[model samples]
Target chain A: MEAFLKYFDLLELSQEAGIEDVRKNYDYLKNLYSGDSIEIAALNTDFSPELRQEYLARLDDAHEKLTQLLENKKPAVAQNTVRMDDELCDWIANIACFSGAALKSIRERMVVDLKDMFTTTRIQLQYLEDIENEVFESFRAEVYLRSYLVEYTRFLSLDTPRVLADYLPRYRAWAASRTTPAGMPHL
Target chain B: MIWAIGGGKGGTGKSFITSSMGTYLAQKGRKTILLDADLGGANLHTFFGLTRPRYSLTDFFDKKVALQDISVQSGIANLDLITGSIGSLDSESINHGQKQKLFRHIRALDADHIIIDLGAGTHINTLDTFLLADRMIVVTAPEVTALENMYHFIKSAYFRKLKFIFKAYDLTTSIQETWKNRATYDIHNLKDLIIHLKQSSDRVRDIFDREMSGFVVHIVLNQVRTPRDILVGENLKSVCMNFLGLPVVYAGYARFDEAVLKNINSKEPFMLSNRLSPVATEIKALAENIIAGTHISVRKDVANGSLS
Candidate 1:
């Protein structure tokens, strides 16, 4: 832990800082030392070129090490999630009907695990699986399902209003098909 | 709190910032005193639209005038000014005993805050007054000349502080001897000198580390014209920490505004006339940051040149 903290110190961040914080500070420090700004030029008398190179090298090492450390510490399922390509993003945007299977397929194509979704959204794991499977009976009421869907879509950085507009109707259709209306379950 | 504003170069807005901050503090209901300690060229009174005062620091030093007696009201409520003598008692002439006495009297003044506007250059008198402040602030522009002088000033102040520590311990000769043969000791910079001294004895190491930790200098970037210019403060802080091993607080920055020059030329208190201007807002933020012992946090996007 002490050794790990030294990396945070190098980036001028606290140990509890998030991965975003680490990346931001890393980019900042890297840009600062790599360039020949007046600030660096003014210190030429004290900081030689060789010394600056060493400092930059140390910064790179610290950034690389911290990224790996933070990556490993993330919930197992999120470790493999890659940046969304434009094509994938376009496809997700063109998703006219957000069915449970479609949402599951989108998650799969993005390499996002259900457990990671659960970890981030903090929705019950069983309920998340149920929602992905379109198990309408599993949800006690429409409100719970709608709220969970909102959280899940937001976590995935999708357009919440559009996703809700497409997906909630299907759940309502399922509720109407049942003999009894989907009302709040008794506590 | 006593805040001393000095950068090693002239015409970088030191007096402007000093007078502006003093005005802001006084307007905020703090009993603030503005002491123009730029003895060689004291014109902070001009920033407040005031003519030359009847008394100045010359009265305090040449004759035995109390600092309070010499402090003339700045026409603005809750703010007072102590103008430095023009062409009298150049910084070089003020001996160590006089400097000590001035510092003692400054600390004894009854006010919420005393902001001192120091003259340019790395003169020992200027540095000692800067070091005397609870908050030592260095102001600089984006230009290379201003930056170079700022670095020189900060380095001189750091060395002075180190020498003071050694002198307190009666080890001035030891430090002088080591510095005299710096090549042999591999003391290429302040940090290197510190390392060499720390290896000498545990007592010296403790005193050095303790003093270094307490010796923090705040940086204020003036006349910032672009987002890129804002990053200069953070850049200075980074270099000071990494190379000089000095703790620097990037207090904040004031953007370049033509209105500022207009205000100064007209001898109007810029803060009073342009209270809602961007520069005034920045100065207020900087003053608050200084008082809170916090600094402006440069966003990473700004550092990466992503935010214009």
Candidate 2:
């Protein structure tokens, strides 16, 4: 852990920083020292070229090590959840049709949470829940429902066009069932 | 708080910034004292349109007069001026004892802020006085010569500080000897020297890590003409941190305005006359940054050749 933290100290970042922060700071510091601007020119006598090269090498090493460390540490839960099983894939492939309940079953088998999906996709939590529960009335229009489904399927790493092909027909059938036949639905 | 403003090269607006910032602080109701510590070639009094005060640092040194007595009213509210004695005392003439005494009395002076305007060049006296400040500020212009000298000044100050630490540790001779034969140890810069010393023992490393944490210098870029020029401050900060392992705060920058020179010539207090001006706003922001122990955030847009 001490060795791991030294990289963060070199980049002047905290241990809690994400990979993006590490990359940004590394790029900034690298660009800064690599330049031959007047600031560096002034140090010509003292900060020899060899010394600067050595410093740059250290920066490269730190950046590489920090990137690897953070990448390995970042998605421990996500990594475990993303391991696809052959049985699950076969089950998904053999399904006769796609439905909200099928999508919910796949997500639960992978231990993916609705809140995590909302956080990553930035789709509203209520809308995501509505999509999973097949609350078709909550959607304002067919286009909204289609776009939301596409986004939701993409978030789950599902085949988007195929899922849409299977899901849209079901939604259309439900819509047709809800419509009245020639003013017979006044009740 | 005590603020020392110095840049190695002259004519980079060190005194101008000192006077303007002092005036600004005083106008903001802080009892400020402006010390013209440029022992040779002092002219900060002229910025305020004051005639050479009868008693200067000369009295304080030769006559043993108190610093409070040497201070004369700056013709502005809540501001006092201690004019430097021209040609009477150069950096060389002031002994170590005298420098220590001056530093002691400077700290003892009662004021909300004592802004010391130091002379150009990395004189030991100047460096020591600059190190004495609660806030150490370096002012520089955008030109190459100014930037180069600014780096020299900061490097000298950092070395002087390291020497001070080494002296406290009773390893002064060790540093001098190592620096004398630095090539043998493959020490190229101060950072390398520090690393080499740390390898000598754990005690030196601990002392260095503890003592060096407080040695932060604030940079103020003056006379910036273009949008590109403002990025110099950020660049300087980066170089200092990366190359010297020194933490530098880019306090802020002031744009180049001919009116600044005109104000100095006319002896008009620029801060008061141009309080609403952009330069004044920049100076005020920098002063507040220094007071608040904060720095400005500069973003570089390489594609646009501009900064925001």
Candidate 3:
């Protein structure tokens, strides 16, 4: 974000000066930074003729626009500039001071992505919650039913014939735990 | 819209219902993908009678193959299967990176409804996948073990999702922190806590209301032994509403029929073996009601390429 703001400042400075001043300033800055090495490989890189020309044209257009804005070449002004209301002026000032167009664009994109991420995640969370709810409820029911089974064991023990193994501590533990038994034990 | 089928406990028939639903949708001419997301025990393929999946989720995760390549075209028209790599690589082993990768593939897939058969339990991976789906169908039996697991699953998932949403709006407060502390059972009951949150952040209440409104937690009870088992569904609905302040609509109860067992033994969905079987019929009816209730139009999504 800071890097984007720095580039934006340079762009704004270019727009404020005349095209000639912008061109000269660009060269001055470029030379002052000549201590930095230029990549010969970048200039020598192969690109299709049409692509190269189009890229160059874009660079030139960007430079030209910045110079014109910097020069403040006043003619018939476009409606892009207006006497904004106090509220609007304050809003725009806040936005300009606190934001860069490039950064704003990035933030907009990020907001959309975040919204999508959260939306999908929220649904997943609901599913998890449902599973938890169901599982806990099942455990509750198991607790309830297993106790009932214990009561039933005592009920049947008094009245009729019943297998003691069915009422064994291991069976009770297994019933209480509700954990699935392991696959058929290795031979 | 994607609907994840999961139960808190393993072996409560999450894959069974998911695969059967996939089969039913295929028979109805809707393109469907049954994602075997159970990285632990990816046996959904076995339920389909496929001895060996040509490409499993393991291949995709390992970068040995693309997701599309791993997607096996089922014999049933318009149905696709993404086999899970269970025994070889357990579902619990996948970290956040792997889980995100799996979800990305699931979101990009073309299907009318991507029914994710989530791995059992409420680990971060499973919960994350569950949260990513558009809707969720929690399946459980009448047994107590299944109900308890399901309850905890819902509570954790809801808390995690709410925390994410509140944090998104930059409205983190003490209430949010209190909610995360699962120790306090009464946090779900405290109106004062919500009022405190709302006072600190106005949007908190709105976010909570919106999530509570759009959220659909459908409960489906499988393997009912008696009519009394049916009350378990109602009991769950009441608990959700009373305790968590979330609306839970009962999806339906599937009877414990020998046919479900037969399908398992035969390596076929009961719906395929006998569509008219009591349990299969119940499942089909439940599926229909769910689709209708959710207002998911297979035709509309197909037309828009949202579902293909």
Using alpha carbons, what is the TM-score of model 2?
Answer: 0.73
Of the candidates shown, which would achieve the greatest lDDT relative to the real structure?
A: 1
Q: Report the C-alpha lDDT of model 3 over B1-308, residue by residue, as the tens digit.
A: 78887768887788888888888888898889888888887888888788898889888878757776788976778889999875888766777787777778788888898898987888877877888877778888877667768776776777677767767876566555766773554432433355455555546666676665666777888877765566556555534553355667677777777768877898875677786777777777778867765321111111122100
Put down candidate 1 lDDT per residue, B1-308, tens digits, no spaces. Answer: 99999999999999999999999999999999999999899999999888879899999998999988999999999999999977876998888899999999999999999999999998999998999999999999998899989988998998888778878889989778888999997778768878888888877877776677768888999999889889888788777887878889999999999999999999999999998898999999999999887989876465344223
The residue-by-residue lDDT of candidate 2 on B162-225, one tens digit each, is 8788888999987889999999998877778888998887778788878887789999999887
The CA-based lDDT of model 3 is what?
0.60
Cα-based RMSD of the predictions, in order?
Answer: 13.7, 15.4, 33.7
Ranking of models by DockQ: 1, 2, 3
Residue-by-residue lDDT tens digits, candidate 1, A24-111: 8888888887888888877766768788788888888888877765552332455433478999999998887888888888888988
Give, for candidate 1 chain B, the lowest lDDT window spanning 10 residues.
B299-308
DockQ, per-model, please?
0.31, 0.20, 0.01
